[model samples]
Target: MERTEKETTYQETRRVQKGDFAAAGQISASYKNMLKRLGVDSKVVRRLAIASYEAEINLAIHTLGGSMTIIVYPDHIFLVVEDTGPGIADIALAMQEGYSTAPEEVRMLGFGAGMGLPNMKRCSDTFEITSELGSGTTIRMGFNLLN
Candidate 1:
Protein backbone atom coordinates (compact mmCIF):
# COMPACT_ATOMS: atom_id res chain seq x y z
CA MET A 1 0.00 0.00 0.00
CA GLU A 2 1.54 3.26 -1.06
CA ARG A 3 1.30 6.36 1.11
CA THR A 4 -1.82 8.44 0.79
CA GLU A 5 -2.97 11.12 3.22
CA LYS A 6 -0.97 11.78 6.36
CA GLU A 7 -2.31 9.49 9.06
CA THR A 8 -3.63 11.29 12.12
CA THR A 9 -3.81 9.34 15.36
CA TYR A 10 -3.08 9.78 19.03
CA GLN A 11 -3.57 8.41 22.51
CA GLU A 12 -4.94 10.16 25.57
CA THR A 13 -5.16 8.96 29.13
CA ARG A 14 -6.97 10.61 31.99
CA ARG A 15 -7.67 9.78 35.60
CA VAL A 16 -11.31 9.85 36.63
CA GLN A 17 -12.01 10.66 40.22
CA LYS A 18 -15.05 9.27 41.92
CA GLY A 19 -17.81 11.74 42.84
CA ASP A 20 -16.33 14.56 40.85
CA PHE A 21 -19.26 16.28 39.26
CA ALA A 22 -17.13 18.81 37.46
CA ALA A 23 -15.04 16.14 35.79
CA ALA A 24 -17.79 13.70 34.98
CA GLY A 25 -18.34 14.47 31.32
CA GLN A 26 -14.85 15.69 30.51
CA ILE A 27 -13.49 12.45 29.08
CA SER A 28 -16.43 11.90 26.79
CA ALA A 29 -16.21 15.44 25.51
CA SER A 30 -12.52 15.02 24.89
CA TYR A 31 -13.09 11.81 22.98
CA LYS A 32 -15.77 13.43 20.86
CA ASN A 33 -13.54 16.37 20.12
CA MET A 34 -10.71 14.10 19.04
CA LEU A 35 -12.94 12.23 16.68
CA LYS A 36 -14.31 15.45 15.25
CA ARG A 37 -10.79 16.73 14.74
CA LEU A 38 -9.91 13.58 12.83
CA GLY A 39 -12.86 14.19 10.50
CA VAL A 40 -14.41 10.87 11.38
CA ASP A 41 -17.77 10.14 9.87
CA SER A 42 -20.75 11.58 11.72
CA LYS A 43 -22.33 8.23 12.45
CA VAL A 44 -19.17 6.79 13.94
CA VAL A 45 -18.55 9.92 15.96
CA ARG A 46 -22.04 9.87 17.42
CA ARG A 47 -21.84 6.25 18.42
CA LEU A 48 -18.36 6.70 19.80
CA ALA A 49 -19.48 9.68 21.85
CA ILE A 50 -22.33 7.75 23.42
CA ALA A 51 -20.19 4.72 24.22
CA SER A 52 -17.35 6.82 25.55
CA TYR A 53 -19.62 8.83 27.82
CA GLU A 54 -21.39 5.80 29.20
CA ALA A 55 -18.11 4.14 30.09
CA GLU A 56 -16.73 7.33 31.54
CA ILE A 57 -19.78 7.82 33.74
CA ASN A 58 -19.62 4.23 34.91
CA LEU A 59 -16.00 4.71 35.96
CA ALA A 60 -16.68 7.97 37.75
CA ILE A 61 -19.81 6.90 39.56
CA HIS A 62 -19.38 3.20 40.30
CA THR A 63 -15.70 2.96 41.12
CA LEU A 64 -13.61 4.59 43.79
CA GLY A 65 -11.38 5.86 41.00
CA GLY A 66 -10.15 4.73 37.63
CA SER A 67 -8.47 5.60 34.39
CA MET A 68 -9.73 5.88 30.81
CA THR A 69 -7.50 5.71 27.77
CA ILE A 70 -8.51 6.45 24.20
CA ILE A 71 -6.41 5.10 21.35
CA VAL A 72 -7.17 6.64 18.00
CA TYR A 73 -6.19 4.63 14.96
CA PRO A 74 -6.66 4.83 11.22
CA ASP A 75 -9.75 2.70 10.99
CA HIS A 76 -11.05 2.53 14.53
CA ILE A 77 -10.92 3.92 18.04
CA PHE A 78 -10.30 1.90 21.19
CA LEU A 79 -11.33 2.68 24.71
CA VAL A 80 -10.22 1.06 27.93
CA VAL A 81 -11.67 1.78 31.32
CA GLU A 82 -10.00 0.17 34.32
CA ASP A 83 -11.02 0.51 37.93
CA THR A 84 -9.93 -0.89 41.29
CA GLY A 85 -13.27 -0.53 43.03
CA PRO A 86 -15.50 -3.35 44.18
CA GLY A 87 -15.72 -5.78 41.34
CA ILE A 88 -18.90 -6.97 39.74
CA ALA A 89 -19.62 -10.53 40.81
CA ASP A 90 -21.88 -11.41 37.90
CA ILE A 91 -21.04 -10.11 34.50
CA ALA A 92 -24.12 -11.64 32.95
CA LEU A 93 -26.45 -10.15 35.50
CA ALA A 94 -24.72 -6.82 35.25
CA MET A 95 -25.32 -6.79 31.53
CA GLN A 96 -29.01 -7.06 32.13
CA GLU A 97 -31.11 -3.93 32.09
CA GLY A 98 -32.22 -2.40 35.40
CA TYR A 99 -29.72 -4.49 37.36
CA SER A 100 -27.75 -1.82 39.13
CA THR A 101 -25.53 -1.94 42.16
CA ALA A 102 -25.58 1.78 42.59
CA PRO A 103 -26.25 3.16 46.03
CA GLU A 104 -29.42 5.02 46.97
CA GLU A 105 -27.63 8.35 46.93
CA VAL A 106 -26.38 7.72 43.46
CA ARG A 107 -29.87 6.87 42.33
CA MET A 108 -31.30 10.01 43.83
CA LEU A 109 -28.76 11.94 41.85
CA GLY A 110 -30.18 10.22 38.74
CA PHE A 111 -26.85 8.65 37.89
CA GLY A 112 -26.83 4.85 38.01
CA ALA A 113 -29.98 2.99 37.36
CA GLY A 114 -28.03 0.29 35.62
CA MET A 115 -27.83 0.67 31.79
CA GLY A 116 -24.16 1.58 31.59
CA LEU A 117 -22.69 -1.67 30.33
CA PRO A 118 -25.68 -2.36 28.16
CA ASN A 119 -25.49 1.08 26.60
CA MET A 120 -21.78 0.62 25.94
CA LYS A 121 -22.48 -2.60 24.09
CA ARG A 122 -25.22 -0.97 22.07
CA CYS A 123 -23.02 1.89 20.95
CA SER A 124 -19.83 0.08 20.10
CA ASP A 125 -19.09 -2.26 17.23
CA THR A 126 -17.29 -4.50 19.74
CA PHE A 127 -17.45 -4.58 23.52
CA GLU A 128 -15.95 -6.74 26.28
CA ILE A 129 -16.01 -6.58 30.04
CA THR A 130 -14.02 -8.54 32.63
CA SER A 131 -13.98 -8.39 36.38
CA GLU A 132 -13.01 -10.40 39.45
CA LEU A 133 -14.58 -10.54 42.89
CA GLY A 134 -11.95 -8.41 44.52
CA SER A 135 -9.75 -7.54 41.58
CA GLY A 136 -11.76 -4.74 40.03
CA THR A 137 -12.94 -4.42 36.44
CA THR A 138 -11.94 -3.50 32.94
CA ILE A 139 -14.22 -2.66 30.05
CA ARG A 140 -12.93 -2.53 26.51
CA MET A 141 -14.80 -1.04 23.59
CA GLY A 142 -13.96 -0.61 19.92
CA PHE A 143 -15.75 1.52 17.37
CA ASN A 144 -15.07 0.80 13.72
CA LEU A 145 -14.69 3.88 11.58
CA LEU A 146 -14.98 2.23 8.23
CA ASN A 147 -18.50 1.41 7.32
Candidate 2:
Protein backbone atom coordinates (compact mmCIF):
# COMPACT_ATOMS: atom_id res chain seq x y z
CA MET A 1 0.00 0.00 0.00
CA GLU A 2 1.26 3.46 -0.86
CA ARG A 3 1.52 5.65 2.21
CA THR A 4 2.89 8.97 3.40
CA GLU A 5 4.19 10.18 6.73
CA LYS A 6 0.81 11.67 7.60
CA GLU A 7 -0.64 8.16 7.84
CA THR A 8 1.55 7.29 10.78
CA THR A 9 2.06 8.56 14.32
CA TYR A 10 5.83 8.23 13.88
CA GLN A 11 7.97 8.25 10.77
CA GLU A 12 11.61 8.49 9.82
CA THR A 13 13.07 8.94 6.35
CA ARG A 14 16.63 8.95 5.10
CA ARG A 15 17.93 9.65 1.64
CA VAL A 16 20.52 7.29 0.24
CA GLN A 17 22.96 8.50 -2.36
CA LYS A 18 24.17 6.21 -5.10
CA GLY A 19 27.50 4.52 -4.43
CA ASP A 20 27.74 6.04 -1.01
CA PHE A 21 29.75 3.18 0.40
CA ALA A 22 31.20 5.26 3.19
CA ALA A 23 27.75 5.83 4.62
CA ALA A 24 26.23 2.53 3.64
CA GLY A 25 25.05 0.96 6.91
CA GLN A 26 24.54 4.16 8.88
CA ILE A 27 20.98 4.82 7.78
CA SER A 28 19.61 1.41 8.64
CA ALA A 29 21.54 1.37 11.89
CA SER A 30 19.87 4.62 12.79
CA TYR A 31 16.51 3.04 12.03
CA LYS A 32 17.33 0.15 14.34
CA ASN A 33 18.32 2.53 17.09
CA MET A 34 15.11 4.50 16.73
CA LEU A 35 13.00 1.38 16.72
CA LYS A 36 14.67 0.12 19.87
CA ARG A 37 14.21 3.45 21.57
CA LEU A 38 10.54 3.47 20.66
CA GLY A 39 10.07 0.17 22.54
CA VAL A 40 9.50 -1.91 19.46
CA ASP A 41 9.88 -5.66 20.11
CA SER A 42 13.40 -6.97 19.92
CA LYS A 43 12.45 -9.58 17.35
CA VAL A 44 10.70 -6.99 15.23
CA VAL A 45 13.67 -4.69 15.48
CA ARG A 46 15.99 -7.48 14.37
CA ARG A 47 13.83 -8.32 11.37
CA LEU A 48 13.55 -4.69 10.36
CA ALA A 49 17.23 -4.23 10.86
CA ILE A 50 18.01 -7.07 8.47
CA ALA A 51 15.43 -5.97 5.93
CA SER A 52 16.36 -2.31 6.13
CA TYR A 53 20.04 -3.03 5.75
CA GLU A 54 19.35 -5.08 2.65
CA ALA A 55 17.15 -2.36 1.17
CA GLU A 56 19.71 0.26 2.05
CA ILE A 57 22.52 -1.70 0.46
CA ASN A 58 20.53 -2.28 -2.70
CA LEU A 59 19.78 1.41 -3.09
CA ALA A 60 23.38 2.37 -2.42
CA ILE A 61 24.79 -0.13 -4.88
CA HIS A 62 22.19 -0.31 -7.65
CA THR A 63 19.94 2.69 -8.22
CA LEU A 64 20.66 6.37 -8.88
CA GLY A 65 19.30 7.30 -5.45
CA GLY A 66 16.44 6.53 -3.07
CA SER A 67 15.00 6.81 0.41
CA MET A 68 14.42 4.46 3.32
CA THR A 69 11.36 5.29 5.36
CA ILE A 70 9.97 3.76 8.53
CA ILE A 71 6.36 4.26 9.53
CA VAL A 72 4.96 3.14 12.84
CA TYR A 73 1.34 2.15 13.07
CA PRO A 74 -0.57 1.04 16.13
CA ASP A 75 -0.33 -2.64 15.18
CA HIS A 76 2.34 -2.67 12.54
CA ILE A 77 5.66 -1.29 11.40
CA PHE A 78 6.04 -0.38 7.74
CA LEU A 79 9.01 0.26 5.53
CA VAL A 80 9.07 1.95 2.15
CA VAL A 81 12.11 2.01 -0.06
CA GLU A 82 12.03 3.90 -3.35
CA ASP A 83 14.74 4.43 -5.91
CA THR A 84 15.31 6.72 -8.89
CA GLY A 85 16.21 4.81 -12.09
CA PRO A 86 17.50 1.62 -13.68
CA GLY A 87 14.89 -0.56 -12.10
CA ILE A 88 14.65 -4.30 -12.23
CA ALA A 89 13.83 -5.79 -15.62
CA ASP A 90 12.35 -8.93 -14.11
CA ILE A 91 11.00 -8.77 -10.61
CA ALA A 92 10.09 -12.46 -10.57
CA LEU A 93 13.61 -13.44 -11.48
CA ALA A 94 15.12 -10.92 -9.15
CA MET A 95 13.13 -12.31 -6.25
CA GLN A 96 14.63 -15.70 -6.75
CA GLU A 97 17.21 -16.58 -4.15
CA GLY A 98 20.81 -16.65 -5.38
CA TYR A 99 19.86 -14.78 -8.55
CA SER A 100 21.76 -11.52 -8.91
CA THR A 101 22.63 -8.98 -11.55
CA ALA A 102 25.57 -7.58 -9.65
CA PRO A 103 28.78 -6.79 -11.48
CA GLU A 104 31.96 -8.78 -10.99
CA GLU A 105 33.50 -6.04 -8.91
CA VAL A 106 30.45 -5.75 -6.68
CA ARG A 107 30.46 -9.48 -6.13
CA MET A 108 34.14 -9.30 -5.39
CA LEU A 109 33.37 -6.79 -2.70
CA GLY A 110 31.51 -9.61 -0.86
CA PHE A 111 28.11 -8.05 -1.33
CA GLY A 112 25.14 -8.74 -3.65
CA ALA A 113 24.87 -12.46 -3.25
CA GLY A 114 21.34 -12.03 -4.57
CA MET A 115 19.72 -12.31 -1.12
CA GLY A 116 18.51 -8.73 -0.60
CA LEU A 117 14.93 -8.97 -1.81
CA PRO A 118 14.52 -12.49 -0.62
CA ASN A 119 15.80 -11.61 2.82
CA MET A 120 13.56 -8.59 3.05
CA LYS A 121 10.54 -10.65 2.08
CA ARG A 122 11.43 -13.40 4.49
CA CYS A 123 11.81 -10.99 7.37
CA SER A 124 8.64 -8.97 6.89
CA ASP A 125 5.05 -9.86 7.69
CA THR A 126 3.93 -8.44 4.33
CA PHE A 127 5.91 -7.43 1.27
CA GLU A 128 5.23 -5.80 -2.11
CA ILE A 129 7.55 -4.67 -4.84
CA THR A 130 7.15 -2.72 -8.08
CA SER A 131 9.71 -2.00 -10.76
CA GLU A 132 9.95 -0.65 -14.29
CA LEU A 133 12.82 -1.43 -16.59
CA GLY A 134 14.01 2.14 -16.99
CA SER A 135 12.23 3.89 -14.15
CA GLY A 136 12.86 2.60 -10.64
CA THR A 137 11.77 0.21 -7.88
CA THR A 138 9.76 0.56 -4.74
CA ILE A 139 9.48 -1.97 -1.95
CA ARG A 140 6.91 -1.88 0.81
CA MET A 141 7.09 -4.15 3.81
CA GLY A 142 4.96 -4.45 6.92
CA PHE A 143 5.67 -6.16 10.21
CA ASN A 144 2.96 -7.12 12.61
CA LEU A 145 3.34 -5.98 16.19
CA LEU A 146 1.34 -8.84 17.60
CA ASN A 147 3.49 -11.44 15.98
Give the TM-scores of the predictions, in the order they appear: 0.90, 0.92
Candidate 2 has what TM-score? 0.92
What is the per-residue lDDT of model 2 for residues 1-147, given as tens digits with 9 covering 90 to 100?
455656676887889999886688898898889888889999999999999999988998899999988889767888999998799998999999999987787788788899999999999999999999788999999999987
Residue-wise C-alpha lDDT for candidate 1, range 9-97, written one tens digit per residue: 77778999886755788788877887788898988888888888877778777887889988777987888899987789899999998
Give the clashing pairs for model 1.
none
Residue pairs in collision within model 2:
none
Where in model 1 is the C-alpha error above 4 Å? Answer: 1-8
Task: Report per-prediction Cα RMSD to one decimal.
Answer: 3.7, 1.9
